[model samples]
Target: MADLDRSSDDTSVDSREDTSQDSKLEFTEDEETLIARMYSLLGDRWSLIAGRIPGRTAEEIEKYWTSRYSTSE
Candidate 1:
């Protein structure tokens, strides 16, 4: 299991640069405002939240939120 996790991490690192350059994960200022509003209104229902935002999917939103906002503690 540790090896599996490590391999996945390695893959992510290898792809990060190429993916980052072409990624659609970065939200615009207006989009950020709208997402915050939607998040407040909808809570953790990312799919519904994503539906309200064009050009963004639930997975992308969830990944961004997890990486940016979620705390270990």
Candidate 2:
């Protein structure tokens, strides 16, 4: 029926949106704080700890750390 087709189309659209979102990684406030603090306390040497978090690159983590410190100073 036409109704079924519309419902399926909606589901497909929603799925595509979700997939697109998942392609980029987002950090929570807590995660940002934790990463920032860890970097601050240790300084640019986050390689060991960065391995634990999923979807985040070490470069991104380091850039965030530097940006936070630069603004605070």
Candidate 3:
């Protein structure tokens, strides 16, 4: 029982680390250019755009694009 608890705790910690890492989304200059070009060609097709960029998910790219480009109102 104690070992199982420890195992679960370790898994939880690992998942938390992964989540934190995923949240810190940093795009390089080349990636930014690619994203812009892809947006022009694809027009909001996030999944298709993400498929072209290695190690990026559609949600991450969409979030970055929105935060970087969205107009403040």
Candidate 4:
């Protein structure tokens, strides 16, 4: 039981660290422009779009786009 709690705590800490790190990601103007353009051309195909933007992963791009460009936002 103690071991299970410790493992769960570790998982929670790792997820918190991930979210904190993700919040720090910033896109350059050029990269943002490129991502927007690529999104327009490619639609919601994030992996394909990410390939065009160096140093950015698909997950990061998708998260940023959804947060900033989603219709609800």
| Candidate lDDT values, in order | 0.83, 0.72, 0.93, 0.89
Worst 10 residues of 2 by lDDT: 64-73
Model 2 reaches what TM-score against the true structure?
0.49
Clash pairs, model 1 backbone: none
Q: In model 1, what lDDT does residue 46 have?
A: 94
Which tens-of-lDDT digit does each residue in 1-73 have in candidate 4? Answer: 9999999999999999898686548888898999999999999999999899877789999998999988962
Ordering by lDDT? 3, 4, 1, 2
Model 4, C-alpha of 17: deviation from truth (Å): 9.0
Q: Comparing 2 and 4 by lDDT, which wins?
A: 4
Q: List the residue pairs that clash in candidate 4.
A: none
Off by over 4 Å in 4: 1-24
Summarize candidate 3's per-residue lDDT along 35-69 as a digit string, tens digits.
Answer: 99999999999999999998889999999999999
Q: Write down the lDDT that model 3 would get.
A: 0.93
- Give the CA lDDT, 0 to 100, for residue 53 in model 4: 83
lDDT of 3 at 71: 96
C-alpha RMSD by candidate, in order: 8.8, 6.0, 2.9, 4.8
Model 1 per-residue lDDT tens digits across residues 3-70: 99999999999898678746687878887787778888888899998898877889888887788778
On lDDT, the stronger of 1 and 3 is: 3
Prediction 1 global C-alpha lDDT: 0.83
